[model samples]
Target chain A: MKLIMNLMASILLSVPAFIASVHAETAVIVSLDNKNTYTSIDKELVARIFLAKVTKFPDGTTAKPVNLKQGHYLREGFNRDFLSKTESQLSRYWSRLRFSGKASLPKEVNTVEEMKLAVANDQSLIGYIDAMDVDDTIKVVHKY
Target chain B: MRIGSIIGSVLAAVLVTTTVQANSGDLNIYGFMSVGVGILDKNEVTIEDFEGEGNFKQDTVLGIQVSKQVNDNTTATGQLVSRGSSDFKTEAAWAFISYQTSTDLTARMGRLRIPFFYYSEFLEVGYAYNWVRLPSDVYNIPFSSFDGVDFTQRFSIGSLDNSIQVNYGRLNDELTIFDENYQSDLKNMAGISLTSTYGDWGFRIAGQRTEMTLDTEVDEAYVSAVQVATIAQMTHSANPTPQSGVDLQAAASALAEAEVVFVEQRRIDQGQTGAILLAQQMNLDLEVQDEFAFDGHVADFYNAAITFDNGNYSFIGEVTAIEYESGLLVDNRAWLASFAKRWGDTTTHLTYSTSRDVLNSGDSGKLQEALNLQGEDKSVTLGLRYDYDVNTALKVEAQYHDEIMNRGVEGDYAMLYSFAVDVIF
Candidate 1:
């Protein structure tokens, strides 16, 4: 009886914590050595950068935005909260722009770790990952 | 020429595959396809081949585009599109070199899509919009592309994102009107479009002017009408002549006693009332033929559109009008309104559209009725689009046309059902 009660308590206590982790805040990050002089960015600028509407950052440095692959959960959250677009909406938008030769899609990485590596290796690149994954090699510019 | 088209398509495919396989640097390749089958309950055709029987050749299309960054500020791009309606022949839809002067301005030269409508540039890309096909009432212009130079400037006003495009171009191609082919030439073409977006609302307006000419063949009905009228006039007039008086001058001179023959021959050639009054009574306008055939006439086109899109729901409305200085051709106006809602992976859309020709009061109006070119129709369509995957979609649509003007004949109400699978890579 005691053993069963302990298992039930543990599961009840950990379930909400697991749910919280899954819905954790997303952090938009830049390289520690990023050339552009900006401590933080607004959601509109982030949306513009990710959409490839603006090729340069506020300070006029060429900005290269990176994206996590299609099915990444953190990427989905970031797209919804920061860009205010759904995956399908973004897909259609990018299709029009890319096929018309007006703009190209941002470089896509397969995993959050790869996203971190890509942004850290290129000072011009900006990407996002889970807040818990933020590290010293990258600077968190915005959170949602 | 058919062999050349085949060879060109083969070469384009080979090049695309080789470049993609090699993973060439700074070279990007993309492709899209939509394979559709449609059938109508009525005997009249709607979209090229959607007649009484099921047809797959009208809406099926494939397109491939390639772009390379030529330098820091320039890019080279080319697109090839194949349509089943044309027996799967491939054509270069766009081939241009774009130079970015600034982050806000871009200039491109070469063959480009005519900026006549909001969706003109990506008209063939099925996945770009919500419809199985765009409404023909607003999109069935004879010309699609022109060899040209265009300047696009992007800026913002308040919270609205704005883009202004100015283009100068010319198109020389074969056009099919009334199921007959004519060599069409559009020169001195100039157009401008402005698009503005604020949050979920979008608006666009455009205008274009061009010098248009068509090499048209003489209508047999017109010839017969003139012949019958002339015979009736010569035989029953004050000074009667034989039925064989093919020579208008001789017949007119036979009426010399009436002093009408002294009128200038130039007046007859100009289609004045004296010589062709009987022809006009017979519902034939020889004047229109004299005014427009093989002669350059000025034309103007106008378009306006508004769109609203949120995550789950969207609405669009568009209107277009065309006018010609010489009223030989139909001056048409078209409009469409559409609403769509998304439920999970499926989107349901409802659309209503209509088009009609503006009839005038003179020889132009008689010509319009005589040729039976006064097109007037309306339709309503319901469709569902299912996103099977991130890059692929499946769509099914049913269109109910209250009236369909097919080749100048009014067709009764009919239902057209179609399905399409669209994909991009």
Candidate 2:
């Protein structure tokens, strides 16, 4: 009975860790300001923007994509939306693109506050933040 | 001619307009430029009467690329590249469209890269790769564009990080230079590659298949003229050296070797038909005003490449093969291995790499072919790179080339090097 209980406990402990890594990437929806007029962003377009593959938004407003420096929730959200690539993966990808003249690397801003401020200030700016970080100033386009 | 001029004018207009668009709202524009000086430390080798060492400033390049995003998921990219002296002339290096699927996968279509090896996609990005230049022998095929679709997917497998990519495409190109002629076609290319990582180490393995038809015509007279002209230039370039005359003689001899072989092949094609020989020679003479005229080259080509990487270090190698229908042997292979060590937070790295190409024996129709192969050629390079940040950086590189004469084309060894800086606006 004790062994069975221990086995159950161990299995339960491992599941979340496995699940977290496998699902570390999240799908996010983003927009210009807190208007919340559009609630969903196309999954593919999100990928294109983060990879610097896309230049326009759904409504063709010329979406300005902002990156949350290196270690912010919004940046992670953005990565998940566009490439699911981490900083290193991004580095390698850019290395290839830089050589071919396909695209340049994205702009980096270190803090979520900086991210929020930048996105809020620009009419075309789009950024990804955690669901909890969303406020009246930044509208939620999609959430994972 | 008028249509060509009109098209050229339109292209120029569009480029001017795009440059004006630079960065507006969702639009972002960025690119890079570089220039450098090179020298040959050694010239005039005399082991087997070789005379092509010690030339410099023959290795300079410049490039510019622009990209725009159409929507959240779809994007378009166009790149124009140039190398060698004179402000980087136009080289149709890269032009394509790409799409991303979620965060884990992306796809691209249009004039895509051949993806023959790990560096195939970035062969010209001397700033990105370690080598001063890829081995000319291994990457000898003159073509790198294709109409195809490429798909890349990234995900995890157990404790490993994995990415797999597959590409399919077709390509065709033609060339005409004096009397040497080449025509080619590559149809239906399908290839798959995979990259996996465990800890700081990563690895790649991939392969591809190609089918092609190639047609070629060579002008003996034009080739002879070009050889003589090139010899004259080399002699002028080598004037300061005492062995210049000897080098000239050796070059002339090599030309003779090629001539003897070419004429033999021509005679075979002529066979017993004197009328055929006279008619073909007349046509060839008209077609080849200078150098050698290129005939139509049609063929299907395929390639595969694999790579391995460790955070502070990496190595990538690839091999590409193609069969030509134009009775000429067009098979070649090249590989590059690199190792790098990085400094601290500032991001400085030093690396060394080498590339080589080996030519395979070709098929000769009825005509006795010299198979003018010396053996293989290789380029060894050492370089240093510094990245102040992702968008800005600098690189320096040097290379030494060793040549082998195949059946009979003059082969000369050279030493070349360069330094470059990259920036964004």
Chain A alone, TM-score per model: 0.82, 0.66
Worst 10 residues of 1 chain B by lDDT: B266-275
What's the CA error at residue B383 for candidate 1, in Å?
Answer: 0.7
Candidate 2 deviant stretches above 4 angstroms = A1-93, A98-111, A116-144, B1-23, B44-59, B85-87, B102-105, B174-183, B197-199, B218-311, B317-327, B344-369, B386-395, B407-425
Task: Give the alpha carbon lDDT tens digit for every residue of B8-61 in model 1.
Answer: 999999999998868857888899999998888877555433677888888899
Assess each prediction's global lDDT (C-alpha) against the native: 0.78, 0.54
Docking class of 1: medium
Clashing pairs in 1: none
TM-scores of the candidates are: 0.82, 0.56
DockQ (Cα-based) for each candidate: 0.50, 0.16
